[model samples]
Target: MTDLILCGCGGKMGAAVRELASAREDCRIVAGVDLACQNSGLHFPVYRALSEVNEAADCIIDFSHPSTLPSILNYCRTHPGTSAILCTTGYSEEQTADIRDAAEELPLFYSRNMSLGINLLIELAKKAEAVLGDAFDVEILEMHHNQKVDAPSGTALMIADAVNEVRENNMKYAYDRHSQRKKREKNEIGMHSVRGGTIVGEHQIIFAGRHEMITLSHSAQSKELFASGAVNAALFMKGKGPGLYSMSDLI
Candidate 1:
């Protein structure tokens, strides 16, 4: 059984994971670290600080804020052998670089979306981009709840990565339109965002050819799909090599 230490064990995402760990017996939720300093009703003890988690854990799955990236990376650096999963998004350029740096030290699984279905879409999208020619204009359309602050969700970016890898690597991320004078580029990826009333999430990738168009979509009816995917990642990563991996790697 693997020992799991969950970070951000108070928020909604954390709450869902907590429920999951409590229901499972193969792995023990030894400790929970959070800023709000929550006291969990689960069997394990909750600590306000990461340093207080004296137990040597097999993995630390972080679903916390991006603000904690530096500290989380530092902790993984000092611990040497402790594994980590980064579930936070909306990072700055430097923060993304920091994640790469941390990857050199610890086994890291960082993903914007932990949905396996979406990762499979990434694989399919990349293949489609190669098979479909320049005649097809690539576009990614995504929708989330109005509460979402990020314009382009991480899942949308994943899809962009998929398309960019196969094409001439000429995909542009356009969140909005400029003026009527604006002319779309040959390999530009038109990314559109839609916000609505409590939408779980929706992402669609369209490859438009002259007479026909192909679209690939993954819809999340509930957030549990992501939580389940994360769990599967944690279990899959039990004895893997030390390096940074994405949900696409799991798929």
Candidate 2:
């Protein structure tokens, strides 16, 4: 069985992970780290930081914010033979680089979206881009709950990047076209975001041609899908070497 220490245990995703892991036989949460420790109704002891946790964990599942990355890196450095599965988003370029660098020491799994369907959608979109080429115009729309701080969601960017990879990275992202009155550029991919009440998650990729149009979409009905993915990643991290892994590696 995999012993896990859950980060951001008070958050919605963290709570989901906690519930799912509790019901499973392969893994169990040994500890939790969160700033708001008082509100965490976890059966396991919750610490304000990872450093205070004394339980031996085989892997860490972090659903926390990007700002908590430093402490996690430090934990990995100090504690050898422990792997981590990072499920958080909204990381900057420098922070992403840090993650890669730390991966040189221990196994780390990171992904923008953990849903299996979303990853499949990414692959399908790439195939569509290859077949359609420049003849079709690509646009991506993403919707999340109002509390989400990031616009366009990281999954939207992941989809755009996958499509652009097929075009030799020649396509540029156009976040807002309302600033100037001009026709849509052929070399740009449009990105749009919507924030409203209780939207678990929704991503739609539209490809418009002269006479034919194809749209690919993935909607997350609940947070359990992501929690399952994260737990599976943690199990996969066991008995692995140092490297930066993603959903591509697990699936």
Candidate 3:
């Protein structure tokens, strides 16, 4: 069995992961770290800080805030045989660098979004970019719940980057067109964000040409899909050597 430590156990995503892990026999949550420490009816011990936890966990699944990244990295540094699955988004550039650095010492699995279908969408976007070439203009549209703090969800950026990387010339991400009243540039990737209601998540990519348009989209019905992906990543990462891993790696 893979003994796990869950960070941000009090949050929605954390609770979903805990619920899914509870149903599985191969993994168990040994401890949880959360500022609220609300218990959320979990049988395992929950601490306000990672330093207070005494359990030795085989892996850690973090759905915590980016601010908690340092403490999580420190925990991994001190623990010899632990891997980490980071499912947090909206990290600053410095924090992102820290994650890459930490992976050199311990196994680390990181993803902007943890849904398997979303990752597949990224791959499909890349293939479409290659086949359609520069003749088609790409635009990514994403919608999340109003509670989400980040604009243009990370998954949208991931899809944009995947397509941009495959092109002969990297496409610039254009988040705003209102400020500069000008025609859309051919080498630019348009990104639009919508925040309203209780949308779990929705991402759609449109490839527009002169005559016809092709669209690819994915809608998440529930948060359980992301929770399931994180759990699967934790299982895949256990006992691995120091390295950086992504959802594509698991696929």
Candidate 4:
């Protein structure tokens, strides 16, 4: 059985993971790290700081804010054999680099979206990019709950990156176009974000050609899809060597 420590235990995603892991026989939550660790309702010990936890876990599942990255990375650095699954989004470029560096010390899994369907979308996007090429203009649109702070949800970027990787000329992401009064650039990938109501998540990729278009979309009905994906990733990552992994790796 994989011993797990859950970061951001008080949040919705964290709580979902906690509930699901508790039901599974392959893993058990040994402890949790969260600043607001009041009445967590979990049987495991909960601590405000990672340093306060004395028990060692095989892996840590972090659905916390990007601000907590440093502490998580430090925990992995100090602990020789622990692995981690980072499900948080909106990380700066530097923070992403830190994750890559930390991966050299211990196994680390990172994904913008944990839903298996979304990861499949990423692969489909890559295949579409290769087949469509520069004959089509790519546009990515994403919508999330109003409470979400990040624009162009990380999943949108993940899809865009997949498309860009297979393109002859790498596409540049354009988030805003109000100021520019020019025709659409051939190598530009337009990214649009919508925030309203209680949207769980939705991402659509449009490939516009001369007279035809292809649209690929994925709509999340519940947060459990992501939560369960994280649990699966945590289980898959147990006892792995020092390296960075993604949903693609798990699949």
What are the per-residue Cα lDDT tens digits for candidate 3 across 119-199?
999999989999998999999999999999998898998899899899855789999999988899999999999999999
- TM-scores, one per candidate: 0.91, 0.97, 0.97, 0.96
lDDT of 1 by residue, 31-109 (tens): 8888785584656778877877787777788877788777777777777667787887677778888888878767889
Question: In order, what lDDT does every prediction score?
Answer: 0.80, 0.92, 0.92, 0.90
Q: Rank the candidates by lDDT, best first.
A: 2, 3, 4, 1
lDDT of 4: 0.90
Which scores better on lDDT, 2 or 4? Answer: 2
As for candidate 3, its clashing pairs are: none
Off by over 4 Å in 2: none
For 31-64, candidate 2 gives per-residue lDDT tens digits of: 9999886643568998998999999888999999
Residue pair clashes in candidate 2: none
Better of 1 and 2 by lDDT: 2
Those runs of model 1 whose alpha carbons end farther than 4 Å from true positions after fitting are 40-42, 178-180, 239-241
RMSD (Å) of each candidate, 1 decimal: 2.0, 1.1, 1.2, 1.2
Worst 10 residues of 4 by lDDT: 33-42
